[model samples]
Target: MTDTFLIGMLVLAAGLFAVGLFGVLARRAVLFQLLSLEVMLSGPSLAFVAAGARHGDPAGQGMFVLVLILAAAEVALGLALYLRMARTADVTDSDSIRDLRH
Candidate 1:
């Protein structure tokens, strides 16, 4: 039963990762892109936890926590950049952001 549960959790995490990747590739909207990034980061965190549980190891949990911190920092920086760009360009699309170079 435990093995089955672990496999299911891993499969779900993989699916989340795939969806996040697809969203990043296919979405043009900045907000959707950000959301997809979050999903991508979170999927691995969940997988880490599941792996730790399956292996009975504490290091995986620790790694997951570190990854979470990194993800938070990334979100902060990304949001700050988006805010600066939005203020100057008055648009949130990535293509329009190119106007900021000049």
Candidate 2:
């Protein structure tokens, strides 16, 4: 029963990862892409927790916490860049950010 539950969790994680990847590839807006990237991160976090639980190890939860910290830092940086771009160009779409050499 526990194994089955873990398998289901893994499947859910995979689905989230696929959706996140699709968002990153198909979306045109920078905000959407960032949101998708978070989703991608979530999938792996879920997997880590599930694996840790399956093995009765505390490391999975620890890894998930670390992933959260990393995600927070990434969001902080991404948002700072997004704010700068918005201020400079009033831009939200990634395609318009091509002129990055300024």
Candidate 3:
């Protein structure tokens, strides 16, 4: 509830988001990118929980749940595409997947 604690939590949230962003930008593999995207989503989820706790409000938690659902859907879709690419073209790098047409 203290300002210091809240600031620390926000900093941590920012760090998580930054790390995930870096991973997404730096990695070329589809799987790593997907994992990084999850991490990115987690950053906001943590921030929402922390803010909700700090303010004694349930809205933050509700937002976190929504974010969780979004992340899950993204993972499912991403994995499906990755699998399809893997099976059909043996491609894992994003740059190599320029065209979907065969």
**Model 3 steric clash pairs:** none
| Model 1 spans with C-alpha error above 4 angstroms | 99-102
Q: What residue pairs clash in candidate 1, if any at all? A: none
Residue runs of model 2 more than 4 Å from their true location after superposition: 99-102
List, residue by residue over 1-102, the lDDT tens digit for candidate 1: 398999999999898898999988998778788889989988888888998999899988999989989989988998888888778778688777777688
Regarding TM-score, does 1 or 3 come out ahead? 3
In terms of lDDT, which candidate is strongest?
A: 3
Which candidate do you rate higher for TM-score, 1 or 2? Answer: 2
TM-score of candidate 1 against the unseen true structure: 0.88
lDDT of 1 at 73: 94
- Candidate with the larger lDDT of 1 and 2: 2
Reference-based lDDT, residue 19, model 3: 95
RMSD of 1: 1.6
TM-score of each: 0.88, 0.91, 0.94
Each candidate: RMSD: 1.6, 1.5, 1.4
Worst 10 residues of 1 by lDDT: 91-100
